[model samples]
Target: MASSTSYPSYKQLKEDFVSNLSGGTVSEIALVCAVAPVVSLLWSTLQARQSFFKPYTTLGFVVDFLLNVGALLLSVTLYSAVPILLNLLLLTAALFIYALPPNLSRKKPRLLPDAKSRAAASAGSLGVLSTKPFLTNYRGNMMVVTCICILAVDFRLFPRRFAKVETWGTSLMDMGVGSFVFSAGVVAARPVLKERADNKYIPLGQRLVKSLRHSLPLLVLGLVRFLSVKGLDYAEHVTEYGVHWNFFFTLGFLPPFVALFQSALRVIPSYAGLAVLLGVVYQIVLESTSLKSYILVGPRTDLISMNREGIFSFFGYLAIFLAGQDTGMIVLPRTLKARKSGSQWTMLLTLAAWSLGWMVLYHLSTTYKYGAGLTVSRRLANLPYILWVVASNTALVSGFGFVDAIFFPAFYNAHDSKTEKEAYEASTSRILRSYNRNGLVIFLLANLLTGLVNMTVPTLDVSPVATMGILVAYMAVVTATAVGLDMYNISIKL
Candidate 1:
């Protein structure tokens, strides 16, 4: 009997990898980001003599708590360790304040309903997180810790060799952990991130301008950043993307690119194929001529010109962006519902299959840096890594769906709804919901937070773990605060 077996082609494999990579990281964080708001809603409900817990909103609290652990691990560390001490101080103060005969808020304000509360202002952004009567207690610490991590960061590592300018300009270290994933994933998960579901019928010029606007941030940042490479140009140095805001530079154009793709997606099958063709052709051209230098180089209008490595590689990124948008259309479900349990086994099997594929790529690319999964070259996005991303993410969604199925009666922890599990909380939901809407904003703030951290703290003397801890705690608070501010700044037109 003819065996029903066929391997994913190189292109197919890579496509899958990139798709899941974008989806997994964003969705996971998005869920985590949702936690506090939903919790707020739940708390609000309980205060109103409502149900035990809100609807799917409880998922937001779970997501926040889980993600905070991850954020602390990735962002906190020795250099920005002030938060550790400040956290202690804040906790002590909170304990003393709460322990007083009267609620501190009573003497000062009716804190909850007061329109004056802002995420960055509230002790815990008014999310009512934590496992005690001290929910609001951690709010103050959250802000200081957030500021310390973001504003007072020092990305330097000790006992490590000095990094050359070129290395920093090009390597993944300059990008930060999950940095490329942020940009590449944005490009990949175009459908969901974008607000357009019916842009297919839109025209091209409109799309171009739309793309321009979305990419403007990256475009401007890219240009300015290129200027930042002046020292590297003269001294034969390049950056490794360490603590630099490259994620913003790469992702700025995404908003517009997505808009363009949506307008052009009516024939996604054909256009998507064409996008791949265009990418292949562009890559071949780079490899064909010494024009790689000319083509890769950006606006050499001066002595200290920025090398627009990714930006100048327009066809390359455009291909990737289109490929990503297409992925959302092809793989994303129109509705959130499960038809059967078989999907779980299917997802697991696929994950295993993809993991095995990555192993093969890794073994083959042993000579390349970063496990050859993502070569240290800024100009190239490794095929294997992209595949790993897609598969990894697809697997997450699939597995979650399946698990939700098996434990449908027990473990229903999915944030597949706009609202929470039930309407138990009120004020909290309104606040956290604002954060979900401000994801890209949160990301930008995180970059600025990183910058602020760099300006104040000197990471050169600290350990990576310590630095990571500081940064994560700081980011968590900043994220919470920013979300709170957004809620307060709500605008509507009738």
Candidate 2:
């Protein structure tokens, strides 16, 4: 093993390597986004053939791991070289499975009730169970992609175009943090959208306290990470989130801040409008003031100055979260209703329209050079960046939704009748369920493993083959940890 002191300081070397590179084209990044859902659809198709594949058994879990996570790993590493072709192959497999006899699909397990009973139950419990499997799939897939990219970006096998851009452009990794925030907002919207049974409202102060209580873990994690990085002399990308601020702190503050506006979130008819308003206002502030320059090139003197990127970008992330909440409001109920009716075309089309609309807005914001006059900047999380995050995440979720509707409609609709354990076994990939169950743990583990790898190996100098081997082993360990926790029914929630 190479000694840490033998090479140039890891911090300077890593920062210099990643700095100042423009990201890939939007079309290419979008294609990369499609790979996850497409591969997931193929996995769902295989699960549907339970008679042949014997799904819900231990054997089935192994297959699920291989097909879902394994395929996703390939998509981001090797198959990334030919994303279009990989997507084509996955889509072809899914279509072939779809064309099989309807009888070939898994029969409704004995635990679930009939369609009518399940529908009534689902309607009655909608408030309690607003989350559907497809949402789980979306969040899990996004987590997988993020986990892969966080470490993979250091390797030669990972395409430079997909790495995070220094200032302003779209890339797979650029979407990671924004998408994670957006996904959190999606799930968080459930409670916001749920109507009070007695028409009673919780007081804003109480809500703030509760939100803060929930966010406490994130704040602690942020502090721990900050101390660890500095104490251990870990490689620090100061511009990414600033010297002291990090994603955990950004995540921590959002819930409490949003909680302060619980009344507004409820009273406003259009959360999307609220999101746009926030984004536009922030963009105006960035354009008309010196804040942009301060964030981009200003000297760091005090605490605020040192963490300018994380602090200023909080508003943009908040905007992205609000946008996601708005989308969740639209999609969650529709997804449940569609489960009963086996029709999701209207919902799918609505998501498509929203995605296209956001994309057009993003284009106008970047192209016309009128207002904001900015390209997408993850560093600043400005208007264009917010729009891009919303657009791409919505599109990715839409793709996952389409896969569920077309490839495994019966599984979602009928599986609700199963017991909790049975449902876990009978539904889509268990690996995804595991990932969903232990997302925070997986992320923490990935971060630790990333640090370990950097300390032990010359990640920047590794050959492509060695990079692939390291990535595969890293992902395997992460995946196994997720599965093991879930196997023991251990949920390490924050």
Candidate 3:
């Protein structure tokens, strides 16, 4: 075991390892974003033809693990070397395999024989809700990418260009925090929309309490992480969040702050407009005043100053959350209605338009001659960063929806509830669903394992093959745990 006297040196070494990265080009980052959907499409295609591959159950699990996790590992590492070729190959394979007919055995039992009966059995019940399997798959894919990158970024094989940018730029890991928050905002739209439609607004105090209750677990986790890092003398990146603050703290306190303004937010006709107003105002404040300096270069004398990055960036993240909510409002309704109305084209067009619109706005914001000349910064989470995160994630969700619509149209737009349900069950990625069901648990486990690996091995000094092997083993453990829990119908929700 390493001695206590050497801990600080190890800390410095690890911190320096990830420092000063400039991140990748926007197109490269966008390509990385496309990886999850592409992999999901491949997995879903294989899953739909499970009857054809029924004899190879063990091979099925292997393929599922590879697509769900291994492909992501490659995206951040090897894919950087031959990105275009790898992406084209995966996509071409997906389309080719999808075109193959599922030769079902006549004697094989159907999973759901009476689809209509099953639908009728649950009719007029709370279970019959407007659901979107693609949304679930999108969230699952995001979690997988996030889990892969957290530890991979520590290895030599992981591309520095894909790591989190130091001050300002785009990167694959930089998208992790913003995208997670945005995904939360996306799902949050359901309840927000429900509240508005039901016209039963909870009291502000009660909402605040509820928000606190929701945030309490995250707060505890943040404290545990902070204490553990300090107690263990772990490698700390002060600028990433702060001296004592972590991502958990950022995630924890955001909800309560947003809850404080829930009433005001309700008054606004559009959440997107509110997001625009907030983002513009926040950007103006950053440009016109010393607030940006206070965050970027200010003295860390007190608690607030020490954690300025996490504190001030709150506004930008809040704006992002709102924008995501608006996006959900736009996209979710179409998804729910598409099943009955078969409006796949409408949903597809809506997603494409939103993706393009946000990307254009992001381009405009970062353009020196035509626009604000601001760069995307995860630390600051400024206007351009917000636009970029929203655009990229929206594009990812759109890609998943497109893949489902194109390759699994029967599953995506079944005419009746029974067929749709049956098709969804058949085509959905079970491992991805497991990850989705217990996201927080998986993330926490990944963090724990990342720390364990860094402590046990010199991640910065490992060879490429060693790095790959370690990462594969790490992800296999994580996914296997998720699958096991899912098999037992266990979800460790926090």
Order the candidate numbers by lDDT, best to worst.
3, 2, 1
Candidate 2: tens digits of C-alpha lDDT, residues 84-163: 99889888987897778755445654444476576557644333343556778899888888888889887777887888
As for lDDT, the candidate ahead, 1 or 3, is 3
Q: Give candidate 1 regions above 4 Å deviation.
A: 1-67, 70-153, 156-200, 217-249, 254-279, 291-305, 313-316, 335-376, 382-436, 462-473, 486-494
Clashing pairs in 3: none
- Please report, as a residue range, the 10-residue window in candidate 2 with the lowest summed lDDT: 415-424
Lowest summed lDDT over 10 consecutive residues: which window, candidate 1?
126-135
lDDT of 1 by residue, 1-494 (tens): 99899976533432232221111122333232222222232233232333222333556444543333333333233312233343344345434543445322322233353443342243322111111111121121222233333333234431111111131122112222223332243234543433344434446776667557657766676556555444333111222222232445556665565555554555644434645455446645655776555533435553323434444434444554554444344333322234234433443455446445534543443335544323323344333233333333333333333322332221122222212222112222333344333544554565555644544554455576676567557755765665566647753210
- Residue 338 of model 2 has an lDDT of 52
lDDT of 1: 0.38
RMSD from true fold, candidate 1: 16.2
Q: State the lDDT of candidate 3 residue by residue for 1-494, as single tens digits.
A: 86667344766877888875688888987777777887877776765654533443677778878887888778888877667776888889877877888655533354475864575466432222345678878999888889998999888788888878888888888888899989888877887667766778888888889889879999999999999989888887788888888888878887887777677765777777787788999999999999988899999999999998888888888988888888788766634444556576687778789889988989899999998789888889899999998888888888888777665666554545666666665556777888888998999999999989988998888998889999999999999898889989997867
Report lDDT per candidate: 0.38, 0.80, 0.80
Give TM-scores for every candidate, taking all chains together and pairing residue i with residue i: 0.50, 0.89, 0.91
Regions more than 4 Å wrong, model 3: 1-8, 49-56, 106-129, 334-340, 411-420
